[model samples]
Structure formats: C-alpha cells, structure tokens
Target: MSAPLLQIDDLSVTYWDRSLLGLRANGFEAVKRATLTVDAGQTLGLVGESGSGKSSIANALLGLVPPSGGTINFDGQDLATLRKGFPPEIRQKIQAVFQDPYSSLNPSMTVEEIVTEPLKVHTRMTRVERHEKAVELLKLVKLPETHLHRYPNEFSGGQRQRIAIATALALQPSLIVLDEPVSALDVSTQNQIINLLYERRDALGISYLLIAHDLALVHHISDRIAVMYLGHIVEEGPADRVYHQPAHPYTQALLEAVPLLDPARQRARRAERRGRVTTDMPRLSEKGCPFSGRCPHVMDRCTARMPPAFTVPDGGTARCFLLDDEPNEQGRSKD
Candidate 1:
C-alpha cells in the first residue's frame, strides 16, 4: 500500500473564550484527537451533525484554522509547521469548494476571472492561456463558454456551484476539500452536483475530504466513510459497510433518520425511533464514553470508562463497549 495523500493523526482543534480583561477564560475542543486518512484518488466522506466538528476539521485541513494539537501530513509535508504564509506550492496543490456558492465566489468577478484566478496565482500563464484554461474548466464542469462572461448572481445555485468546482480545479490540485458542497441546493440539483463531483474526481484522479451531515448523500460518492459525534470519530470503514451495517449507535440513528422512499419503511422506522427514549443534549463527560448518556445500550461500564475502538465484523472499527467481549485483536484503543 502507498502512503495516504492526506494523513491526520490525533488531530485536535480548540477555541478559547476570552475574558473582558484579555485573558483566556475557557476553551472548547471542537475536534477531539480525531484521526483519519484519505488515500490517493479516493473520497473520504466525513459525516456528522451540525456542530459535530465536521467543518472544523475541514477548516483545519485548509489552513483556515490551526490545530491545537496533533499532526496533519499532506503528501509528506507537515501542515503544522507551515504557520507563516502556507507555501505557494503546497497551497496550489490543495484547493477548496465551499458550501455556499453565492458567498464563495465574488460577484464582481466573471466566471472567466474567478476560475482562472488560481492559474494566475499559481502559474505564469498569459491572459490568453488563462482564458483558454478557464473555458476548458467551465466545460469540464458542464458549463458553456457563454457562461464565462456572466456573474455569479446571474446563475442558479447549481450553476454557481459548478463554477466554484471549476475554480477549484483550475490548478489541477491533488486534493480538494469540499465543505458541504451540495447542501445548499435543491434535491435534484444536489444529485446533479454530486454526480458532477464524482465524475470530475474519477477523471482527474483527485482525492476529496467531503464533509456533510447526510450519510446517504456522501455514501454514494465516498470510497470510505467516517462518523463523528461530539468531536470524536465513533466509527469508520468502507462506505458500503458503514452505510449498510453501521456498527455505532449514532451511525445507526443517523441512517434511520434518513427518510426512506417507501412509505411503509419510513413509518416503521419513525415508530421505532419514537419507542426509544429521546433525551436532551448530553453533557460532555471527561472520562467515560461521551455518547453514553443518549445511547440506548448504555451499560454501567460505559459510564465508568471510555470504550476502545472495537474492530467490527465488517472490517471497520466502532467505539462501543458492546464489543468489549471481543478479543484484543478485534478491538484496540485509538488513544
């Protein structure tokens, strides 16, 4: 096996609340020692609820926010050490597509200018060459040459997203961090954008760290999936295994929450969920399992100590005490 394109080990990101006196009063860990990897030319879908630190991880990866601890190795370079301006070479190789297309692109800039901005910054391409490349990128995203002169406001939400994607591809980066790229679009448009991204990734041989709250949406495009809850990765494995046979309770609940197309199945799942006890937001525990309070299968041992990452039968790991009976080889602590 080759080295992963992006390797994140024990990554932690924290935000400090300041007092009026200019002192740090409290700190919140948005990401808690999270570890995951994205292999070359593979999409790693990171799924979690809002405030579960999905965007935090994305921001950290893009260098918009610094990690409080741990190492982020992107193609063998340490991201932590690049605190000063991120090296132009490194920056060029890692691009980003944000969620809100309207906000991500500048209204003043035409599609041609927006898409070719990266080329101008990263390469010594002439204006004519940049324009030609921009046209090609627009075509790659299924937009026409006529759309090049138009502003972002003139295009629909989906078209704007395509423009954003084209801009990201301008430099032919190795990895593209997509932070909820299609969450803002309508259902049909979302599918189109997802399909476009899937096609582009396969054709370009690029890796993606796709962050989204919907497991069903990302499962289609991702080669692997990781589930995050309250900042910790509770489960991770192949996309099919994680989607079809989720080993973690949170993952199961998330899957169950996705409305099924069949009326009967949807009703049945809804009724089943109602039968289970629903509680208020759980208080963060320092020692024991962070999910124990809301977990239906919570055991005494669950509250006593944090469970290790148990190897699931489907070739993945789940952080749950129910697997404690399994052999040591079948389970190991990430900590």
Candidate 2:
C-alpha cells in the first residue's frame, strides 16, 4: 500500500467558553479522539447526522480550527506545528468545496476572475495565461467558455456549485475537502455534481474527504466510510462492510433509518415501530457512549463507560459494547 497522503491521529477539537459565574467551562467538544488516514487517489466518506463533528474534522484538517489535542500529519509534516496559517505550498495543495453553493462564491466576481484568483495569488502566470487556464478548467468541469464573463448570480444552484468546484481545482490540489457538496441541490443535479467530482478525481488523481449525511450517495462514491456519533467516530470500514454488516449500534440505527422503497420491508418495519428511533444523541458534555441513550442494543456497560473502537472484518472498526466480547451476536433485544 502507498503512504497515506493525510493521516489524522486522535484529533480532537474543543471550544472553550465561560459561564456567568466567571468560571471556566467547556462550551462544546466538537471532535473527540478521531483517527483516519487518506491516500492519494482514494475517497473517504465521513457520514453522520448534523452536529456530529463531520465539519469540525474537515475544518481541523484545513487549519480553520486549531485542534485542542492530537496530531494532523500531512505529507509527513505535523500540521499543528506549522505556522498559524498554512504554508503557501501546503495550503495550495489542499483545497475545499463548502456546502452552500449559493453563498460560497462571491457575486461580485466573474466566473473567469473567480477561477483565476488562486493563480493570481500563487502563480506568476500572465493575464493571458490565467485566462487560458480558467477556460481550460471550465472545460474540465463541462462549463462552456461563453460562461466566463458571467456573474455567479446568473447561474443556477448546480452551476454555481460547479463553479465553486472549478475554483477549488484551480490550484491543482492533491486533496479536496467536499463538505456536503451536493446536499443542497436538486436530486437530478446532485447526480451531475457527484459525477463531476468522480470524473475530476479520476482525471487529476486527487483524493477526497467527502463529508456528507446522505448514505446512498456516500455508498456509491466512497471506498471507505466512517460513521460518527456526537463528537466521535463510532464506526469505520470499507463501504461494503460498513453498509452491509455494520457492528456498531449507531451504524445499525443509521442504516435502519434510511427509507426503504420495498413495500414488504416497509410494511413490516412500520408495524414493528420499535425502530421508530429518536434522532437525539448526547451532547459533548454528556458522559459514557454518545449513543447509549438511544441505542436499542445498549448494554449496562454502554451507559457507564464509553466503548473503545474495536477492529472487525474487512479493515473495519466499531465502538459498541455489544460487540465487545464477540459473543453478543444474538438477535437484538431490550437494552
């Protein structure tokens, strides 16, 4: 196997605050002891419900948020040890496409200017070369050259997202963080953007950290998936293994939450109603397993102690008490 392009070990991010009593307090712990690695030409999907620290992890990687603890190793260098902002070389190598397409791009800038901004800042390319490169990138993203002079406001949501994606590729980054890149678009448009992303990855040999909540889309695009609960990664493995045979209670619950179109299973599931699970998980302040309160398979230990991530088959890992001894494989029962 090739060396990891990015390796995050036990990365944790905490927000500090104080109460009215003039006492120090932890406002929120966005991420907790999470670890993952990404290699060149590979895509890793981080999936979870809102406030699960998916975005926090991405921000920490990009240096938008300083990690309170742990290390972020990129290209064998410690990111935390670097200067306040990223070194120009490192910054240009890791770009990002945020969630909101409508808000991500500046309305004041023309498509040509938007795409060429990075080159202007980082490259000594002349005006003519920058414009040429902008057109080339537009073509790479399937946008027409005629759209170069148009403003962001003139384009639809999907087009704007494509423009944002084009901007991200302007610097020729080796890795891109796509934070819910398609969640806001129409279903049909979502497919188009996803295809564009996949195509770019293939053509550029770039890696992706796809942060999303859509299970089906993640399943289709990711080689590996990490399931997060509250502020920690509760399960992670190859997409097939994590999707088909999830061992973590949170993973199982999330899979069951996906609506099934099959009439038979839908009817049975509706009748069962036992799976009408609440979406609520504990906050960062809560102790024990984050999913313990809502987990149907929660054990006594789950409520008293947080479960450690245990390795499983197909290079997978899950944090759940039920899988602790490898003997709790019996059918689901009361907690």
Best by lDDT: 1
Instruction: Report every candidate's CA lDDT.
Output: 0.89, 0.86
Q: Give the TM-score of candidate 2.
A: 0.92
Q: Per-residue alpha-carbon lDDT of model 1 for 15-84, expressed as tens digits?
A: 9999999998799999998889999999999999888999999888888888999899998898966777
Model 1 TM-score on a 0 to 1 scale = 0.96
**Could you list the CA RMSD of all candidates, in the order they appear?**
1.7, 3.9
Clashing pairs in 1: none
Candidate 2 lDDT, 1-335, residue by residue in tens: 77799998888988878879978696778898899888888899999999899999999889898888888898878896664889899999999999899999989999999999999999999999999999999998899999999999999999999999999999999999999999999989999999999999998999999999887788888889999888888988998899888888788777877889898998888677564665554533356788877776666767666677777756778877666555444323212
Q: Model 2: number of clashes? A: 0
